[model samples]
Target: MKKKKFLLIVLSLLVLFAGFTLTKSFLVSSKQPAPVPTSVVINEEKAIQNFSKALTYKTISFQEREKFDLKEFDKFIAFLKDSYPNVHEKLDLEMVNDYGLVFKWIGSQSNKKPIGLTSHYDVVPVLSGTESNWENDPFSGAIKDGFIWGRGTLDDKIGVIGILEAAEYLLTEGFTPSRDIYFMFGFDEEIGGDLGAKAIAEKLKQRGIQFDFVLDEGGAIVENMVPGVEQPVGVVGISEKGSATATLSIIGSGGHSSQPKDRTNIGRIASAISKLEETQFDGKLRGPGNDLFEFVAPEMNFGMKYVFANKLLFKPIIEQILLKEPATAALIRTTIAPTIFQAGEQYNALPEEASAIINLRLMPGDSLEDVKEFIVNTIDDGEITVTVTGTEASSISSTEGPQFEAIQQAARNVYNDSIIAPYLMFAGSDAKHYDSISDNTYRFLPVQISSDDLNRMHGTNEHISIKNYINAIKFYIEIMKVTNQQ
Candidate 1:
């Protein structure tokens, strides 16, 4: 009788556990359905034509500084004034550092904190030899085959032109916000936003201005980026990875290659790098990575959903699965890339010094000093001199509350079919500069694009579909309407 009672108790416990697991799986998706844009009507052909014309200006940001097309930038500024006469006429416009633009639309309620929408007008160069690879002259801004082909169309000009298109439409319709709205455009974001966004932030700081939120370009609507979720996920970047370069240098006794030591400088440096690659940062699916799965797990299939919903018990398995792809792997940890390796110039000579530069994208909690220590400890070689320098990751913006909700609602109004979620950005953007002057910052461009199109952002044949561009304009209109209501 005692043994039979014990067996019955065990069966009851198993049943309770299964029931709890099933309950959590069903409750995984807290995402409410996004509202559709029922009343927004935009001039589709005119919006497309305006974007195509904006792409023609070669306002490229070359690292060398001298290669900048100031003339084209001048023309682009003029184009903005001409294209959106209503905006230029009504909003208070100011120029910063010659090329940057700050346009403020005064709100009815002066006491309410202002909000900002920013994007860089500058674009990366069409790498010299690959210009011919484009389907059209990258600067020509050709509209053909249902796509607008050009350099800036995807990398950023979309943000500038899209925002302006919406604002112009709203102004023409005589719609004004209850709270102030600022449109900031930076010219140097392609290199580092120092001259443009950094300067703009400082100017705002001196004026005693603080924003409720600032939106800039970073994430996009991606198809098949996440597994098991059939709808395109619109990722709004709540934070971005920090970038740093760690140099591993070694100095040993000079010797001929013929009579090399067991552990020469070259060998030591190579070993250090090998160890770095072999033992990467301990990958943990926590913080933003965990939150992302939490948001999307409900949309995943039964097998994947079961694993993610019971994350505490199944974390190890989830981490292993995420680590399988480099892209997803980057979402979890500080990534290391061996960008530059330098050693002896001559083939025959093995002089004294050897070095390698590893570029790292830091996680939010990682301090630069701690990263340096982690590298030295991992390599465990006294001869290897590791020097580290890079920016720390941006502070994690709030994923909860009205700021994010406004963004989601705006996006959903246009692309109701896509699943919108907050995510951490792998790349840096001008959004980082606004951290101090705003209550919050969000990075997303309401554009429906594929991974193949994403690759073309800084590569050849860059373009955006006409349908996507039209939807982008409409999305902006909705964002302004919804957020201004807040």
Candidate 2:
């Protein structure tokens, strides 16, 4: 009788556990029904022509600061004034730090805090030999085959021109915003936005200006990007990973190659790197990474939805699946990549010193000093010294409330079928700098693009479809209108 009662109790517990999970799966959902899209009409031809023309200026941001062509940037600024007369004439324009452009559109209500729309105009330079790979001239800004071919067409001139075009159209329609809107354009974003965006952000902070939210170029509507979700999903970055560099160096005795010691400088460096790779940063599905799965779980097929809904029971299984792909793995944990390895100069002679640089994208809450200690402990070698230097990850922005809802609603109004979700950005953006002055900072590039298009960014043959460009402008207009209502 005792044995039978014990078996019955075990059976009851198993049934209770199963029932609990099934009930939770049925209750949890992140999916929202598609809303009716608001009608927006614009002169498609003129907008396309303007965007195409704006891409012609080679305002490239080179790593070496001396290579920037100030003349081209000046011409680009002039082009903006000439193309959008009303934006320059009506909005208060200030040239922050000479190249940084700040345009403030005063609204009817002064009580409401302002919102900012920002993007960088400068683009990565076309690699010297890769020029031949482009279908159209990299600098041509050619409008053919229903696409505009150029570097900045996608990387960001889209944000600058798209916002201006929408603002110009709104001015023509005599539409005044309920709250103030500021459009900021940075010149040098590719090489760490220190001069352009940082200066602009500091300037605003000095004037005691605090914003409700600031939107900048980042995640976009990607098709076939999210696993198990058939429809295209637009990802807005609520937080971005911090980019830090860790240098591991060693100073040891150099002997003749013929009578080399068991361990050389190069060997030690290689061993340290190998150990770090084998033992990577512990992966945990939390923060923005966890938020991404939560948002998409409802849209996933029954099997995936069930697994994610019962995350408490299946968290390990889900993490194992995510860890399978490098792209997906980056979403969960801080990533380490050894970019530069330098050692001996001569092939035969033993080198006295060796150094390797590991590029790390830190997850939120991971400090640079902590990461350095981790490296030092992980390597476990006293001979080798480790040093880490870079900015910590940006603060996580709120996904709730009207500010975020305005962004989501605007995206839905433009792309009715796409699911807009908040995510963690693996790459960095200028939006991080605005965190000080803005209550919330969102990183989203309002365009529907594929993984291939993402790869082409900062690569050869970068371009944007005409339809996508116009939709970007429409998104900007919708966002402005939606935020005004809030």
Candidate 3:
């Protein structure tokens, strides 16, 4: 009789737990209905012409600074001045560090903190051998098949020209911002942004100028971005991963190829890399990656919604699923990419020293020292010299408040069918540099694009559809207006 009573008690507890979980899932939705979009009119013909013309300049950023052509950059600057006369005439412009452009539109309300829009003009150089793969010349900015084909069309020139065009339009409409607006363009974002964004940020910091928010080019609107949601999703990057380069090197005795030792320096380096790969950084759904799901759960199908809403009960299962894909896996943990391997120069000789460089995109809380220590412990090789050097992850920005709401509403106004969610950026951007000066820096490139288009960035045959280009301008305009009202 006592045994039967204990079994009944256990079953009742299980039933209650299940009931509570289902109820919680149903009530967990945090989605607020988006506001009605304010109609924005832009001159599509003139905007396209300006965007196409801006891409003609060869403002390419090369790893080696000496390879840049100052003439092309200078011409691009001149073109902007010729194109947007209203912006040049009304806003105060300063050329920081020569190529870095800063324009300030003094606000009607001085008590309100300034807001910033930033993007880089420099683009990555196309590979010499891949030029034939392009249907149009990468630098030609060909308007073919309703697509603008060029190198910088997607990587970032869109942000630079889009923001300027919107500003020019607003000025023409006799609209002034309630808060001061600053437009900043960097010249060397492709390399490290040290000369461009870093310099501009330093200058702003010295002036004791703090921004309410600064928006830069990053995550974009995409279809099938998340697995469960059917509508297109626009991801606003609330934080970006820190980039670190770790070098693993070993020195050992050199010998002839025919009689090489069992453990050569090259062998040690390769083995170390293999071990690091097998033992990756811990994948946990915390921080921005976690925040992404909370915002999207309400829109997901019932099954996905249930699993995500009760993460405490199903966290391990969800993480395992996220770990299955390279794309999704990056969201929850730091990533390891072995980019450069250097060892032997000759065909028949075993070099005494071998070195491999592993590039890691660190999670927000993962410090440089923590990453280095993790690498050292994973390899378990006392002989291998491990050295890590790079900047730590940028501070995570708040998803709440007017700063985020303005961006979310602006995106919704332009792409009403899409859901806007905060996501962690796996790659680095110039926005990280601005974090020091701004209270919150958000990375969102206001364009609807696909995975194929993303792959084309810094690759052959890069292009943006005409429709995407126009909407990008509209988003900029909306963002400006919405931010002021907030």
Comparison by lDDT, 1 against 3, better one: 3
lDDT of 3 by residue, 1-486 (tens): 999999999999999998998898899865644766758888898999999999999999999999999999999999999999999999999999899999999999978999999999999999989989999999998998899989889989999999999999999999999999999999999998999999999999999999999999999999998988999888999999999999999988887899998889988899999998998999999999998998999999988888998998999999999999999999999999999999998889999899999999999999999999999999999999999999888999998888898998888888988889899998789999999899999999999999999999989899999999999999999999998796
Clash totals, every prediction: 0, 0, 0
User: Candidates' lDDT values, in order?
Assistant: 0.89, 0.92, 0.92
Best by lDDT: 3
**Candidate 2 lDDT for residue 443:** 96
Worst 10 residues of 1 by lDDT: 29-38
Q: Residue-wise lDDT of candidate 1 within 85-114, one digit each (tens)?
A: 999999999999999999999999969999
Best by TM-score: 2
Q: Candidate 2, which segments miss by more than 4 Å at Cα?
A: 1-7, 31-34
Candidate 1: stretches off by over 4 Å: 1-10
Q: TM-score for every candidate vs. truth?
A: 0.97, 0.98, 0.97
Candidate 1 RMSD computed on C-alpha atoms after optimal superposition onto the true structure? 1.4
| Deviation of model 1 at 431, angstroms | 0.4
